[model samples]
Target: MKIIILGAGQVGGTLAENLVDEKNDITIVDTNLDPLRHLQDKFDLRVIQGYGSYPRVLRAAGAENADMLVAVTNSDETNMIACQIAYTIFKTPNRIARIRSHDYDCESEQLFSPEAVPVNHLISPETLVTDSIYQLIEYPGALQVVHFAEGKVSLVAVKVYYNGPLVGNALSSLREHIPHIETRVVAIFRQDQPIDPKGETIIEAGDEVFFMVASQHIHMVISEMQMLEKPYKRIMIVGGGHIGARLAYRLEKDYSVKLIERDRERASELAAQLKYTIVFYGDASDQELLSQEHIEQIDVFIAITNDDEANIMSAMLAKRMGAKKVVALIQRRAYLDLVQGSVIDIAISPQQATISALLRYVRNADIVTVSSLRRGDAEAIEAIAHGDQRNSGVVSRDIGAINLPPGTIIGAIVRNNEVIIANRHHRIEPGDHVIMILTDKKCIVDVEKLFQPINLSL
Candidate 1:
């Protein structure tokens, strides 16, 4: 596949890095020369230094022969225009644009029609990040939460605690602990090393465990691995930007919400727009202001300010001052590496979250959902099976009979809205949505090939 990407920023650079090794011809375009040079030296791809919205720039970047065009520049107008140009002139097969403003209604057909912007896929990083934070708040003890098979199944990651019921027990004991609830432990990470999970494997405290369970059984499975925190009631958010405002509004109904903004006018604007949230006009890193607001009593403190330094400082201060859990939005990957394991309970990169959403479209197979785990070292994919026994590699075969790549495990299958945990004797049929965990991403091509239905002539 040939892909042309606009904007050499964090999201574009990360996307390029993931796709370059997948046997695809990738070309990146950006207005800045420094980032382009950086990408050029690191990856085996073409980089163009020019404005992405211009026809000459697109042509210079080989958009004429491109199979897909991804416009992700910071400006919404620029991205939309680039997509329109790609459709009108280049006739690119796929066009994806990153749009930030909430003004454009995605539900409206006229917004993306060929007569208008013609963007086949629209990605809103802010919306994706906000949804992620909402899921974390919903499940208090989960380090990461992602839905699969239309929300019927979920993949959750939790850190084991000393008090957990199954922390020091064998993996097989889960059945005895909860006889009725169905779940599977897919992967475990201790000290950043992947351990193969088996029936006799023991889960230790401080290990990061990943499991798959029915959406209704998520809380039950989490409790066995970690002590569940009390449901969040008091929430404080720093930064009245799009993500902060949206998250505050979403939580204000169920929890006490307070929003802090450095600018008085923006804070006042947010106060007028929000119905239940209390907007505070002050610096989020100001120790005096945080103490005045009783940060000690806040159940969850989220720092989402645009400035990475401010978010990190504020989250660290809140955690030290007695906030139960602190989440910081760190844009730069370097900053994320520095703060994630040190002070912040969770450090989310907007680009990482956005890249996960984009990967679904890039995959060759009919992938319904894809998520990056272990900071891009692994992935979880959900794909639908098609064709008959003779034509398909997976369909009409027992899971044990199918040849799966190493470091990959079948987690669950969703058939007609029913969740079935994968077992050796279970047979996969046509139209079954199979979810698999891949610890070694290099086997992704082989996995996709296994799910593909090849035409057989009799």
Candidate 2:
């Protein structure tokens, strides 16, 4: 599809780069000449330097031929105007805009619809980031909280601490505390690998936990484990940007939040905007300021400064200084290597996480489901096991019956809602979400073909 993007910031630039690799026709518009030139030099795509809301700018960038127009400028009003302009002038199929205010209601959206200008979707990254932070607050013990199936199954990650509440507990014994969320402690993340947990497996402190359970039952597990999601009495936030400001306000209702900024004017402005929070002007990285603010005893340290290295270093230093939970917002997605837990407790990559979520909405053709590539080697492909597929007479009558290549592990079969993890006795059923962990890049097509042999040539 022909896609036009407004804004040359990290989010837009990352999207253009990622989608360009997928062979999409991408064109970007930004007032900044530097980023426009950078995008042009790095990728084989059109770049226009001007206000995207301007008619000549939109037309010059080929918005008339665009399948989708995405507006994500720093100013919400500019993004909305750009999307509205593209929708009206180009008759674009989709107009996606990034808005700062989460309270934009139908009355506001109607002003930019197809009748006026077709704004198809609106997403506020500020709101999403706030929700993510709220999830962490609700489940302090979990390293990550991912809800799938519209809250049917929730995934939580926990790290074991020495002498912590759950030390030495049997895997089965903990279920008594698990509410009927149909909770399953499926795997243990040990040595950076996911290990299937057995009933006899003892819960050790320092072991990273991955539990899939019903959303309603999360608190039950917490109570049973005897670990409380401690209500943060105090939070220290570095960087007073949109993400930080929103997070501070959202958190201030429950915790005393202090947002520190290096910019005196911006800090003063944000102080007026936010209530129940203290905005201070200071050099956050300066150890003297951190000492003065008493960052060592803060329950949570949030590093959301615009600078990646600053955020990482501040978070690392805070953890070193004995802060309980250190959450850092990393702007650039390319620096994933530096955001590991060794740098911060929670490293939220906004661009990468946003793009990952968007892919689920844009693609899923012929493919039923797809997960991230592991070890950067191959993708795990999941397809259906039909009756005709079973009868094809390559016919060993089961997965073991097939002549398959090495490094192919059939992980699970979803017959109805139940996910059977390598329970080989169960025969493959038609309309099943059959899963295989592939070790090679090209085997994805081969694996898909085996599941849907009638389209073998595909």
Best by TM-score: 1
Q: What's model 2's lDDT at 132?
A: 72
Model 1 clashing residue pairs (backbone): none
How far is 189's C-alpha from truth in model 2 (Å)?
A: 6.5
**CA RMSD for every model?**
1.4, 6.6
Tell me each candidate's TM-score. Answer: 0.97, 0.67
Q: After superposition, how far is residue 73 of candidate 2 from its true place, in Å?
A: 4.4
Can you give the lDDT of residue 102 in candidate 1? 74
How does model 1 score by TM-score?
0.97
TM-score of model 2 relative to the true fold? 0.67
User: Alpha carbon lDDT of residue 242, candidate 1?
Assistant: 89
Backbone clash count for every predicted candidate, in the order shown: 0, 2
**lDDT at residue 211 of model 2 (Cα atoms):** 58
List, residue by residue over 1-458, the lDDT tens digit for candidate 2: 68888999977887787567656799999999999899999999999999989989999988888888888788878888888777766777778877766456325656656676467776666666666777877776666665543344455566676755668978877655443435556456566555557678888866776555556666666544446666668889999987888888888888888999899999999899998999999877788788888888888888887788888888888887778889887775555545655657777766654554443333322345443331122334455656464344222246666655555555555566765544344466666655554444344444544654454445
User: Where does model 1 exceed 4 Å of error?
Assistant: 105-109
Residue 300 lDDT in candidate 2: 88
lDDT of 2 at 156: 59
Question: Which tens-of-lDDT digit does each residue in 354-399 have in candidate 1?
Answer: 8999999999888999998866768999999998898888999999
